[model samples]
Target chain A: EPEVTQTPSHQVTQMGQEVILRCVPISNHLYFYWYRQILGQKVEFLVSFYNNEISEKSEIFDDQFSVERPDGSNFTLKIRSTKLEDSAMYFCASSEEVGRNQPQHFGDGTRLSIL
Target chain B: GESVGLHLPTLSVQEGDNSIINCAYSNSASDYFIWYKQESGKGPQFIIDIRSNMDKRQGQRVTVLLNKTVKHLSLQIAATQPGDSAVYFCAENRLTGNQFYFGTGTSLTVIP
Candidate 1:
């Protein structure tokens, strides 16, 4: 089955540095989302993007965080300044459409580690 | 804030036995619920989902039961196997929105 794919399975960056996580959602999907999971915690929603604009974001997605669909296939999340607390497994998901019947499919995830 | 949560942190079942995982949500507006399974080092994989309008839905060897009055959801796995051991999470969402609120998780260990 077609699936969402994320790049840089592991990312290590210094605190205060900028980091960008990339994802290629399923080709036919129209809505994309970003979620994070702290070690041993539940998955938390970060942001949702559709039609190249952010639909909604959580408080955890603050000023330092931004998402962009630079092209048709690539969706990226950039943190302007990384912090220790930002370290977690970032997952990308995509759904064929936004509806009760359409469930989001997730990628393996990018493990971000801040030093 | 309203949240989704699991009834237990861990459960153990023998191979060939049936396993049931339960979840509860405080948000009455949440009309859709889904269960996901995550193996070690992997992301949540969609297992099954049910809408508030339905009380039960079944898939291959799996059944989801929803109790709207009590705001409870349960996932039942028949003939559980070793490969079925994983951390399972429940998520709730309103059909009007696109975001999903996830529950902590339940660790399932299948004893060989």
Candidate 2:
């Protein structure tokens, strides 16, 4: 089956450094999302993207974070300056269409570790 | 903000037995619910989903029951196997344009 794919299974960066996490959603998917899970915590929604723009974002998606569909198949999340608290497993998900009932398929996730 | 939470933190069952995981959502407006399974070191994998309009939906070896009136959901896994050991999470979506709120998750251990 087609699946969402993320790059760099693991990443380690300095607290003040920048990091870019990339994802390639299923080819036919129309809606994309970024979510994070701190160790032993719930999965938190960061942002949702549709039509090449941000459709919605949560409070956790602050100024330090940005998402882009830089190419036809690539969706990326950029953290300007990583913080220790930013360490978490970042997941990229996508759905074929927008509907409350539609299920979103997720990637394996990129484990971000900030020192 | 609305939150989705699991009633139990963990559950242990023997192989070939059945497992039931429960979840509660504070948002009455939540119109969609999904159950996901996550193995160690992996991401959440979609298992099954139920819409608010329906009370139940079933997949291969899993069944999902939703009680919108009580704002509760449950996932039932039949003939559980050792491979079924993982963390299961229930997520609720209040709107089509909104993001889903995930539950604390229940760790399921299927013993052999």
Give each prediction's DockQ, rounded to 2 decimals: 0.65, 0.72
Per-residue CA lDDT of candidate 2, range A2-45, in tens?
A: 99999999999999999999999999999999999999999999
For each of the candidates, give the backbone clash count. Answer: 0, 0
Candidate 1 A-chain TM-score = 0.97
* TM-scores, chain B, all models: 0.92, 0.92
List where candidate 2 sits over 4 angstroms from the true fold: B1-7
What does candidate 1's lDDT look like per residue over B1-112, in tens digits? 0123465688998899999888987688888889999999888999999988899999999999999899999899999999999999989996557889999899999999
TM-score, candidate 2, is 0.95
Shift in Å, residue A109, candidate 2: 0.4
User: In CAPRI terms, where does candidate 1 land?
Assistant: medium
